[model samples]
Target: MIRWGTSAWLGSLAVGAILAATVTFAGVEDRADAGRALPAPTLSTPPTSSPRPTTTTTTAPPDPCGAVAAGMSSRARLAQLVMVGVDPRGADDAVDQVRAEQIGGIFIGGDAVGLLSGGALGSVHATASLPLTVAVDDEGGRVQRVDQLDGELPSAREMVARYSPDEVRALAHKRGAALRARGVTMDLAPVVDTSDQPGRTVIGDRSFSPDPRVATAYALAFSDGLRAAGVAPVLKHFPGHGNTTGDSHLGSVRSPALDALRGTDLVPYRSLPEFGDVTVMVGHIDVPGLTDGRPASVSPAAYALLRGEFAFAGPVMTDDLGAMRAVTDLYDLPDAVLHALAAGADVALWSSGGRTGEVLTRLENAVASGELPQARVDEALRRVLHAKQVC
Candidate 1:
């Protein structure tokens, strides 16, 4: 990337420096002749000129993801930190978008069966040189993506009530296998939030049980089932969206104080031995003392709570930044994305796609202004790439 003009300018500067040094020495000699006797300049032969032992600088080759990343522009690197939504029916559009932005992943929303049917996703992967995360809300019951194709699954609550944890895991395994068959790599499922909300309420039947221990067991079983099926499961709405004041899709939502969450809502996230190879989605709920009354999605303290207290080393994602009222009502799309990624989220998810160019431009500016450090971006990028097992 070095320009020819820059090299020429450097050469001229080097030559000028040599001339200036010679003239300065000449002036010194003249001054000595006119004013006082000058000692002969030390002429000791330059000590053995040890010829620098023919050193060789060997650069280690880039790792798998690093090799691809090395050739990418800064903007492209930033783009890969975002996961945008694409229509399930628009396989061609999805392919074109991925080719254009080289984004980290894609979320397929709605009930459209076109892209998820008949090997339609193959077209998108055919041209993608990098590993692509194809995610969907396949939690089953109230929220199911491939139920129409693979047969509907019971609600989380219903599954817990009717079947043992092991049986539930088996059901999830089957569902996970079906989703993987449709080319989906990630499932936004097994709500870990412990809530007593009505079955039809926001988190509702999506939750396994109100007891934190029960919720944790069922959630872990579901996650294991997905992992067994080769699809990464995302444990979502962290900090407990189950009992929040309201739905984030409508507007602001507040969670219980952090202290209260430690016993109930946050119980399922005890860091266990590990969350395994999975991603945790931070929700947009406003936590009283931890998040400064702002949504956790854009709060540094909130992400810190997860990374610090929970000991979660896997990738983190933001809940629907594009369509959620909790974010949209507060900030514009581009700013929300910048804030999310800056706050420590590995991938900023905006399930209502588009505005990628605008958001990425703002992120580029954020990096330049030091609002979003390059080190943070690189860390997040590596986490995302690792989640895809690309490197």
Candidate 2:
């Protein structure tokens, strides 16, 4: 049961004051040099279990591709790179595509919990020829998807208010388990952006803390706990989203000076190499030096920084194409998909508007015309398939 009381209240706490007072931990050291001497987790000892299972039931059959390494596949592979939105109630049009297209994954909204639990997902799983990575943004507090049915969980900032990084991890663990029981396989979560700028009021409480070290620690904990619960975790707004003032959902946004971003905003992504398997989500921020005036989702230079500088080999996904300010009403829907893939983004996440097929068809044309290199597509597909296989 969620403890509801004075401890959980967030309104009384002034966010700006808390942020202004937050002490920056020493500049982050290489994972090796952080002097904190906590013992590493071992297989011999496990954390306490959550509430018991109501009944022991037969387990689902293992995936044949479970242990198979990721590789290029004409059909299965192409589907992985296309992450599309399905109707929260699981519309027939969505199910048809899931089966025929053999899509790699699906993103759901809050209303989708009914579809997931009430046989919509079960039927799709039964009908689909290949495994699918079903994901949702249940980041607690503001970005919760299952709250309407299961009750609201605390926000990321709220959790940080009441607990230490360790406790936040435990909360994420329980949250992951609940989603898993409802058949969700992936969590688009742990907003790793260091929310400090006054202009970033939108992502204010969505971020863990203004302190990079605190942000990194809390993010790593959530990722660790989700994986422990058999749910894949994605660290988002890569390169960074913290320094930007405008909401990407509305208009084009840019971060503060590249120097300031390097020092504070990117701490979480920089820390991921030591954190084990983690997926990074690219935001739509336009950093002057890194993106060269284009949004990060549509910039090759931004992708190179994440792949080359950060050395993040796991999948890299773009934020919602529909929400992107660069994608406007005047442009054809398919161009959004083409531009993002061409720019080096791997997974094209939730098509906010209803034009997923239009985008997919354009991608197919790009493949046929040899505009988008087959190698890049193959690499992106491989990453997507590997994620689905793991899920």
| Predictions in order: lDDT | 0.81, 0.70
Residue 382 of model 1: what lDDT? 74
* Tens-place lDDT digits, model 2, residues 287-324: 87778777788789888988887888888888888655
Alpha carbon deviation, residue 255, candidate 1 (Å): 0.8
- Model 2 CA lDDT for position 256: 77
Cα error, candidate 1, residue 177 (Å): 0.9
- Model 2 misplaced regions, further than 4 Å: 1-76, 91-93, 110-112, 197-200, 329-331
- What does candidate 1 score in Cα RMSD to the true structure? 12.0
Which ten-residue region of model 2 has the weakest summed lDDT? 1-10
For residues 39-133, could you state the per-residue lDDT of candidate 1 as single tens digits?
55567744322333343444554365665466678998897788889988869878888888877788899988898999988887655555677
In candidate 2, which residue pairs clash?
Answer: 141-154, 141-155
